[model samples]
Target: MERGRDTILLEGLRILDLTYGPSGGYAGRLFAESGAHVTKVVTGDQEISTFKDSRKRMIRTTDNQLPETIAEQLAVGHWDIVLWDSHMALHLESQLASLLEKISGSCLSVRIHFPSTVDVKEEHALQEWGGWTSLTGDPHRSPLYIGGFPATSLVGAHTAAATMFAWLEQKKGFVQVDALTVVVSALEGVYTNYLETGEVRERVGNRHHTLTPMSIFPCQNGFSFIGAPVDEQWELLERWMGRAPNPNWASVDERQQSYPALEHCIADWTQGMEREELFHTGQAFRLPFGDVQTLEDVKRCPHLNMRHFWKGQHPSDGIQLPWIIYRHSSCKLENRSHSLKRLRILDLTSMWSGPYCTRLFADHGAEVIKVEAPHRPDGIRGNSGESPAPFFNELNRNKCGITLDLRQEEERAKFLKLVATSDILIDNFSPRVMENFGLTREVLWAQQPGLIIMSLSAFGQTGPYRDYVGYGPTLESMSGLASLTGYRDGIPWLPGFSISDIGAGIHGTFALLAALYFQRRFGNGLAVDLSQYEAAIQLIGDYIIEETFSPTPLQPVGCTSIAELAIQDQRPLEVKTSDGKRSISTPWIIDNPENQTYEPAPTLGQHNPLLEDYMAKREWHHQL
Candidate 1:
C-alpha cells in the first residue's frame, strides 16, 4: 500500500506528455500518479474535459507553434521522458523530433493501422478501433464495442510499462505501442487458433466453446455462473443439483457437444435456488459458483473492506477511490526485490488471469513454472489437440511446464516442497479447489513462511461470492461495465474480449510484486485475495465517484464511453460528440530499436525433476 507520507516515488522525475487520446493521456497519468511532474501539452481547442487535473499532473492547452520560452527550455534541459502521441506529427517533424530522439527514455503512441496496404498520412485522421470489436462479441449478433474499457486505457497501460522499463534501463531509445497491436495481442490466441485450425471461434453468447459446464446461468435472483471444467467438478455440480452425472458427459468433447442440454439442465437446477444461497452452497462443496454483483455491492464487500482495498482520495476526483493498488516503498531499478527477473513464481493458473500475470513476469525475466494436472491440463491447451493450441502457447510462453495432481496426497506434499523453493505462488482457481486439495495458504505458509501467494478468483476468497464462477465476459456484465458500454438507448454490449481477465492478470502481477516489496522491506508474507470482478469494478472508479457524489442520478444506461461522456458532459467546451472517432495512426517508425524473443513453452511435465529435487536444493534448475 502507498503511504500518504511526504516522501514520494519518482519524486524528481519530469515528463513532458505531448500526447492525446487514451494512449498518451493514460501513459502520462501513470507517471503523474507515481509522483513524477507531468505536463500534458495539448491543443487548446481539443477536449480536455475527458481528462481531469491531478496533484502532480496538469493539462496545459497550447497552440501548434512552440512558445519561445518553452522552446528555449527544451533546448537547455532534457525531459526524463517525452511521450509523443501520433497526432502531433507536423510539430514533431518541424521542431521536436530531434529533442524527443535524444531523450534517455521516450514512448511513441501509434494507432494501429489495420490491413495496411494503402498509405494514410492525413492529420487528425478519424478512425475507431472498429475492427477490434468487429472481431469480438457474440458471433450470432452484429459487431459491438464495449464501453468502460476504452482502447486508450489498455494501450496506455502497455505504453506506460514500456516507458518505465526504458527509464529503468537508463537507455536512450523510443518504443512504439500500436493501439491495434495491443488489442490484437490481447486477442492473439483466437487468431492463432483460427490460423491453425481454420476454426473460427464464433461468439457463443457467454459460454466457453471448448470447456465443459462453462456458462452463465440464471437463478431466482439474477444471472450467475457455474464453471466446471473437469469431470469431478462437473459431477460435483450435478450432485449439488440432486442429479447423477451422465457417463456420456465424461470428456470435454462430450460435454462441449452436449452443451445446449448441459446449460438447460444447469439453468433448470439453478433457477430454483436463491442466487446468494446457491453461490454459497456451491462454494461450500468446492464447485465454481458466482452471482452477478452491483457496483454498490462491490464497494460494500466485506472482504474488500477487511483488506482495506479501497481508500484514499483520487487527485482527479476528490472522492475516495482505490489507492494506487501497486505500491512499493521504492521501485528503484537497482533493487533486486523490485525487479521481476530476480523472483521465481510457481504458476497454478491455466487460463486467463494467473497466466496473464506470470506472462508479464516471464516477459521481465521471472522464472515461471506453469503447473497442471496430468488428467486435466490447462483447458485452453486441449482446445486444439495433442499439440498445445496457439492461444495457450501465446499466453504461456517463456514458462516451464510440469504436471501435478494436487488432489493426491503425495502430489500435495510434493507441491508444498516446491512451494518452499519459490518466491511466489499464483493461481486463479475457484476458491475451494486449492483448499479441497489441502493446499491452503496456511498449509503452504507453514512450509514456506515468506511465500507470497496470490489467490486469484472471480471473487475474493472471503467474499460471499468467493466460490462463484464467472469469466471475463460475465464479469463485464456483473461489474456494470456491460451496462455502461452500449450505444445511447441501445442494449448493453460485450467488448468482445475478456478485458477483466487481462485486467485481473495485470492487477495480480502488480499485487504479487507489491507483496514481494513488502516482504523485502518489512519481513512479512502476503496472502492476496484478488477478485477479477473487483479488479473490473476498480477500473470504473470515476463512475463510482459520480454515483457517490453528483446530485444528478447516473445509472448504468446504454451510452457512448465515459471518454465520450466526460468529453460531452464534463468537457463539452472541447471536443464535439459528432466528431465521432478519429484516426490515431502515426507515420513514424522505430529506426533501430533493440528486441528480444522468448524461448518456447516447455512440454507438459517436462520439468518434473524440479519437483523431485525441490526438497534437496530448495530450488529448481532452469532448462537452458
Candidate 2:
C-alpha cells in the first residue's frame, strides 16, 4: 500500500470530546488527526455512530443529569483539549462554570453552544466583538441568514483555531470570539484594499478591480475562464488569437479601452475550439485559464485526485468528496506521518457561498473546483455585461471551472457523474433547484453516501421561506442588514456590494471544512444546510447580542461623509465602543486625481496564432 506520508499535525494532544452530530464531531476529528487524541464522551443511547469504533469507546453515565460531573472529571484528568457541543439548557451555564473551575492546568477549552449565561454584561461586548452582521446582504433587502449553517458553527471553529493558537503560544485568559470579527480578520487582503482608498467597498458581482483578462467567457461547448495578470501573457494570448501582438494595445490600459477589439479577437479564436481543448491550451500557455465547470466537470478533474485533494471516501456509493481542507507549505503533509494533515482555508463565499468557501481550500492546498452554469449561472455572473462578465472570475481564482446545463437531462446526468467524484459540493441554489435537478440529499447520498454536501441557499431547506426566491438584496432585507445600514437620518441604505452573501460564502466554507474533517475520521457523510440569511445573522450575532443585553440598540451610521471629511486631512476615523474597545474600517476611494470610472481589463488573447490551432499542435507535441 502506498502509505501517503503522514501529514496530519497536532499529533499528540488528546481531546475530551463532548460534541455531537457533524459540527462538533468534525472539530474533534480535526484535532484528532492533526496529532491529537479525541475521546468522545457521551451519555445515554446516543453513541458516536458517526464513527464505527464507539464499541471500544469511553462512555459516561446514562445520566444526562450529571454532565457537570462528567465534564469536571474529564477536566481534572491530563487531557490537553476539551470540546463541548450541547444546547443551552437551563442549567448549562452553572455546569460549565463548575467544569472550568475544576481544570487543574491551562488546557484548551472549546465550547460550542448558544447564549444562556447569567452575566448579561458580556453579551454586549460579544455582539460588538466582530463578524457583525451589519456588513451582510444588500442595502435594500433585509439581511438574510448566511448560507449553510455558518454563523454559530463557524464561530465554534474559529474558537477552536484561536484556542489552539493560544495553547500553542501558552497564553491564558478569557478570549472571547464570534463569527463576525473572525470573518473580518480573514479579510486581510480585502481590508488592505479598503485602507488604500477612503471608501468602503460595495459589491461588484465577480468582476475584479485590480486585474485584467480575468473573466468568464461562453464557448461553443460552455464557459471557460481566462486570467492574464501581465502584458507578455497578453501577447501570448494574441498568438492564440491568430493575430500578431498589437503595438497600439501594448499596455494593459490600452488593451482594456479596446475591449471590443480584444473580445472580437478572442471570440474568433475560442469560437473554433471545444471547451476542454480551450482550457488545456490556455493552461499550456501559462495563462490562468479555467473552465466554468458545472457540477459535472468539477467531478472529473484529474488534478484533484493526483494532488490527493479529496479524502473522505464513501464505500457504498464510491465517491470522493471535497471538504474545507487545505495545507500550507510550512505544515508539510508528508513530514507528519498523519492520516489527514493540517490545512488552511480562506473562504470567500456569496450566492450559494460555494466559491467563497472553496477559495479558502484553494488558498491553502486543496484542489477546489468551482462549478458555475452558463444559462442560469451564478447570479453574480450576469450583474454586469451581456457577456458572462468578469465578476465571476474575480471571486473564483486559483481553482478550475467548467460549465454545465443542469437543466438538461444529459447535463444533469453529467452533473451527477461529477458529484460522484467531488470531495465537496457547495451550492447556494434553492432546495427546489436541487430537487428539480435531482440533487436532493437522498439522491446525493445514494450516489456517494460519504459526500460532504455544502448546500447554500437563501433560507434553510426546512424553514418557512425554504422555497422563497431571494437574492443578496432580499436576504439582506430579511436578515435586518438593510435596517441596520445607511445614514443616521435618511432611509436605510443598502451597500453596493453584497456583503451578506459574500460573508455567508466565507463562513460556509469554514463550516464545510469542519464537516470534511469529521467525515474523514468517521468514514461517513455530512450535509450542511447553509442559509445565507442565517449566515448573515451569525456574522452580526454580537450586534444582536448587544441589542439583547444593552440598554440601547446598535446605532446605525448612514452617511460617513462627515466622518470621511473629518479624516480627509487627519488620521482615519477609528471607532471605539462605549467600553473602550477600538476598531477601524476603511473605504476604497482612489487618491489619484486621474482615476477613471472604469479601468480596462488586460487583453490576454492578443496574438491570434498563439491561441490558435497552428500553435495548438506544436504545444500538444511539446507536452508529449
What would the TM-scores of all predictions be? 0.73, 0.44
The weakest ten consecutive residues by lDDT in model 1 span: 570-579
Q: Give the TM-score of candidate 1.
A: 0.73
Each model's lDDT: 0.57, 0.45
Which lDDT tens digits does candidate 2 get at residues 1-624? 112312243445566766543345544544553445667666665534322222123656565655655666564667776666434344765676566666635655665442332112222222223223334333354332222223333444454554454443344333333333333433223332343334454332222333345444556786555556468888788777778777877887876666656656676677677777766676566554654543233334444334333344321122211222322212111121122112322121333356655643443334444445555445444344233333333344344444556678875765565565455677766677888877776776666555667667665565344554444544444444444443333223333334565556655654554454444444445566666655554433333322322222334222222223223432222322222323332111112213311111111222223213323353211110
TM-score of 2: 0.44
Write one digit per residue (lDDT tens) for candidate 1, span 359-413.
7676566789888999878876754334665667667767888898988888877
**Number of the top-ranking candidate, with lDDT as the measure:** 1
